[model samples]
Target: MAPLALLVAAFLAYSVPPYLTFDPALSRVPAPPGFAAHYGFLVAHILFGTIAIVGVILQIWPWLRRTHPVVHRRVGRVYVFAGAIPSALMALVIAPFSSFGPAAAGLNVVAALLWLGSTIAGWRAIRQRRYADHRKWMVRSFAMAMNTLLSRVYAPLAFLGLGPSYPKLGELIPAASTLAGTMSMLTLLLLSQWWLDRKPKKPAIAR
Candidate 1:
């Protein structure tokens, strides 16, 4: 039930933005110069973000997680390939457009790269039968994957914290959201690694 709720929330969060006709904050900030040429890039972001959310749902659901490892692997491969790669590409293209300037751009770029690197490393670890390493890398990858959702979570919080009269509250929201989401993911990843490390190692049985 929790996972279903999270999935629904993620979908609505991603889907609602493009349809918004007017936003005071968005209107105040000039669109990034050359936004016209890169409209397709934004489309790519929406596409990959949607795919990643679907991938996560498949990954976390118990019945799907346990009952169909092969199918999961296949889906995961598509998810990584489609979601991670294009997402990273779109991130690069859009990073310069961030109203928060270079620092925010750097963080966005790093986050995207981390997402790609962790995913690839996780795949490699699985192929090498290093399940521990695979799990760790995957945890990191998922952390990066969750950034999309985290950004949304942070925006409202930032708005509330800074108050309505705060100068540039709109601009600050996206940047703060990214930072908060990244930190949250990092904390969760560290805790997951610690828990996994403490578990008893399974003996390697002959196939």
Candidate 2:
């Protein structure tokens, strides 16, 4: 059921963007010169988003997580390396130049940095065999990755609440999206950590 839900979410995320055109409000906004002129950014985003989805699948599957630890590790490395790096770069490029203004830009920067930091920390925790820490960090990474989901949810809400003509309303969308995504991710991470902490540790027999 969990895997099925994740898969559905992933498909919705990957498919939704192609159908939506850029917001008109976004067009009038000042961005760094030539930011939208290149197709490479779009390509990179698709590539990384695809890989991140695949990584999530592997992370959630018990058989893959347990039986092929090396493959899992490799995939995870690809996920963090590709997902966070490209996202950060994209954010850096877009944030300042955002049509939505500084609120959106600032949130983008924060989200990108948090995503990068969580993935790095998760990778480090796993390397040190700190399973508890790894779990927490991975939750953070997953939350960051799930920002796509949050963005989708918030955009509609913003549009509905602010209506079409509201000038500043669009600016709130990105900020709200980022905040919601981060908070959701942190909540899940903390719950998982609590659960892990409560589990009984196995006893080692004396020689």
Indicate which candidate wins on lDDT: 1
Alpha-carbon RMSD, each predicted model: 5.3, 5.8
Per-candidate TM-scores read: 0.74, 0.67
Number of clashes found in candidate 2: 1
The numbered model that scores best in TM-score is 1
Model 1 TM-score is 0.74
Q: Write the per-residue lDDT of candidate 2 for residues 175-195, one digit (tens) a residue.
A: 554445445555555655576
The C-alpha local distance difference test score for the whole of candidate 2 amounts to 0.63
Instruction: Check candidate 1 and list the clashing pairs.
Output: none
Model 1: residues with Cα > 4 Å off, grouped in runs: 8-31, 168-207
Of candidate 2, the 10-residue stretch with the lowest lDDT total is 22-31
lDDT of 1 by residue, 60-167 (tens): 566876899988888888777887767767877776786666666667777788887888898899889998798788777777777756655665765566555456
| Residue-level error in angstroms, candidate 1, position 121 | 0.5
Native-referenced Cα lDDT, model 1: 0.68
Model 2 earns a TM-score of: 0.67
